[model samples]
Target: MSLLKGKQLTHYYFNTSNYTKALENISLSVEEGAFISLLGPSGCGKTTLLSILAGIIEPTFGKVTLNEKNVTETQSEMGYMLQQDYLFPWKKIIDNVLIGPKIRKTLDNQTIEKAKQLLKDIGLSSVIDAYPSSLSGGMRQRVALARTLITDPSLLLLDEPFSALDFQTKLKLEDLVSALLKQYHKTSILVTHDIGEAIAMSDQIYVMNANPGRIHQQFEVPIELRQLSPFDARKHAKYQHLFDRIWEELNQLESTSIG
Candidate 1:
């Protein structure tokens, strides 16, 4: 079953000086429990498309749906994680994880315990009471992950959540997130510019084009690669082949755009 669907989405940004059509005729569907990635150049509106699907921005035309209902109507079923951890500096780690439930007035004894377990599951058990400032970059991102999962969102929108961390930390977090999402059977969409990250972490990848950003092509990771963790997937024999293919195409796309 498709957990989330976007149909012919188009979006525009306007100002007193000029208007830009950021996205055009974008249609996508995310199957239940599947992981997908949006890969493209800098100006391709990947974030814009993600925002539209998340209901953070309204499309100029068409619509998005989650579980066959309008996205706006089912907003609570989605969780969005951004490039930054964006945790409250003053709040303790536990309080940060519980913020969502607290904001929605759903926090209770059960919810609190669940948050604690989530933190422990992500290997942050020792710092439950520590402040965000005391944790390393990787650890803080882990806390952010627990926060997103506490509400048990059916679909997760990850917009370059690991981009800011060191390469080693990024790889570790990729493995951690991939395992947790699969364990919970959650559907996810990640927007990233790194082809390797997309191939390592996604079941399917949509390579996009700029100038009225749209999907230029799609690639499916082989079953052998999909079954492995992101780190191991990068070591597979077929990984380099696919990476070269995507690299060439992206270069061609860039040259075309520049011309």
Candidate 2:
């Protein structure tokens, strides 16, 4: 079943006397516990779509529904993880994880305990007291992930969360994130420019076209990719075939836009 749905999403930006359409009649549905990715070039409105779904931005002519209710009107049930870890330099790791509950005024003993348990579950128990500055990029992102999960969000919006990490670190975190999302049964939507990352992590990928961005095509990742770790998924025989297919589609979009 679809846990989240966007219908005829259209968004625009105004600058003094001129307006630009960032998204155009985009529509999508994310099944429960499924991982979905928005893949396209830099101007493809991927992040704009994500913000609209998160209720951070209102679409010019569409609506986002979560569980049949308008997401903008409902109480927040979404977690957003960005490209940067965004942890406060002065806050300890444990404290950072509790920020969500603290902001929502639900930071009680139970929430605190959950935060601690989440840190432990994410393999950061040994560094609970360490500050963000003391951790590696990957570790900080892990802490950020824990912070997002501590809130027990019904949906997750990931905007290139692993983009800043090293290639090796990105692969490791991809595996970790894929495992955690499945284990928690959280439906997630990731916005990424990396075709491989999208293929490895997503159950469905929406390839978008730029210049008034709209969905170009949709691809269902192979079932075998879902069973393998992200690194192993990269080596699967179908991986290259799928990658080349997406690459061609994206290239076509680019070439068409230029022409």
Candidate 3:
């Protein structure tokens, strides 16, 4: 059964007399434990769609059901990683990572032990006491990922989580995030403009178009299951083909927007 479903989602930004359609009839289902990526050109509704699904903002029209429960009126039952690392500067790394559980009042001793285990599992045990300001940009992002996973949500909503990092850091973190998600058996929906990143990280890619934003294409990757890192996925021949196709699609949209 699908873990999450979106039914005929439509969203718009309205003012006194202007109505800008951000999404129209957007619908998709995510299977349990599947890693899905939503790819789109700028001004497309990738973030907006994610927000709607995450219940950060309500859609003008639609329904979002997760694990067979309607949470459109409640706070999302999923963890969210914004484009920027939303870590607290003054909080120690462990404390910052525990924010989710703190808010939900689930940060008990057993959970704190699990939180420590999560940090250790991610190879950040040594930095557990360090503040966010003391860490490198990549380390901060790792902290962000740790923070999100500590909540142990069934679903994860990643909104360009690595957009702020350098290419090398981004690639490395992709491996880290992918492996962690697999280990935790969490289904994830990643929204990104970088087709290469999407191809490297996702089992399926949903291509979207803007200007009354809508899903334009959906591709179930045609590649053998490879037990390799995200860094290794980038080196696959299939990755190149998928990247080229998606790159071309996005470039076309950019050209049209320019003209």
Identify the runs in model 1 with alpha carbons over 4 angstroms from their true place: none
- Estimate TM-scores for all models: 0.99, 0.97, 0.94
Ranking by TM-score: 1, 2, 3
lDDT of 3 by residue, 1-259 (tens): 9989999999999999888999999999999999999999878989999999897888889898898787564453688999999799989999999999899887799888887898898888999899988998888889899899888788999999999999989988999999988888999999998888888888899999998778888987665523556788888888788788888877887788779
* Per-residue C-alpha lDDT of model 1 across residues 1-259, encoded as one tens digit per residue: 7889899999999999999999999999999989999999988999999999999998999999999999888778889999999999999999999999998899999999999889989999999999999999999999999999999999999999999999999999999999999999999999999999999999999999998999999999888899999999999988888999999999999999889
TM-score of predicted structure 3: 0.94
136 Cα displacement, candidate 2 (Å): 1.0
lDDT of 3 at 29: 96
Which of 1 and 3 is the better model by TM-score? 1
Candidate 2, residue 159: how far the Cα is off, in Å: 0.3
Query: CA lDDT, every prediction?
Result: 0.94, 0.93, 0.87
Worst-scoring 10-residue span by lDDT in model 3: 220-229
Query: Better model by lDDT, 2 or 3?
Result: 2
Top candidate on lDDT is 1
At residue 68, what lDDT does model 2 achieve?
95
